[model samples]
Target: MQPGTFELLILIFIFLGLQAWWIIPIINKNNKFNKRGKDLREEIKQLEKLYKK
Candidate 1:
């Protein structure tokens, strides 16, 4: 016999779950790095403002 709709859906769900499990952490790490970079830029801007005053 062949696979049915439910099996197909389960397989798709598992595949997406695995993909997300691997990808989400990388995405989160990149986001954290981006936030840190943004914070550093803001601090530099503040320092420049203070220096010019």
Candidate 2:
């Protein structure tokens, strides 16, 4: 309610928003990468006999 306090709060939100702009994508990409790796491992497990041949 004080003068300039709202501006500071807005700036903090902007900074957090910018940080999330990259952080969220980075986390999502990391999750996707991990999921893909897990899927590949599962596929390899299912085909392990083929690799031995």
Candidate 3:
């Protein structure tokens, strides 16, 4: 059976919603990882300065 235009639009929205649900968490995780990496780099720089003294 062929889908009507309204049914097609609904299907498209559902697909887009599912894609966003899967993608949003991954984006959030990457941001957190990037922030942690920056923090660690700063800590390392401080440690290196202490060692130089």
Q: Every model's Cα RMSD, please?
A: 2.4, 2.0, 2.8
**Highest TM-score against the true fold, candidate:** 3
Per-residue alpha-carbon lDDT of model 2 for 9-48, expressed as tens digits?
9999999999999999999999999999999999988799
lDDT of each: 0.97, 0.96, 0.97
Full candidate order by lDDT, most accurate first: 3, 1, 2
Q: What digit string (tens of lDDT, one per residue) describes model 3 on residues 4-47?
A: 98899899999999999999999999999999999999999999
TM-score on alpha carbons, each prediction:
0.77, 0.81, 0.88
Candidate 2 TM-score, C-alpha based = 0.81
Compose the digit string of candidate 1's lDDT tens values, residues 1-53: 46598899899999999999999999999999999999999999999999999
TM-score of 3: 0.88
Q: Candidate 2, which segments miss by more than 4 Å at Cα?
A: 49-53
Q: Give me the displacement of residue 14 in model 3, in angstroms.
A: 0.3
- Select the stronger candidate by TM-score from 1 and 2: 2
Clashing pairs counted in every model: 0, 0, 0
Stretches of model 3 off by over 4 angstroms after superposition: 1-3
- Residue 44 in candidate 1, Cα distance off native in Å: 0.6
Displacement of the residue 27 alpha carbon in candidate 3, Å? 0.6
Clashing pairs in 2: none
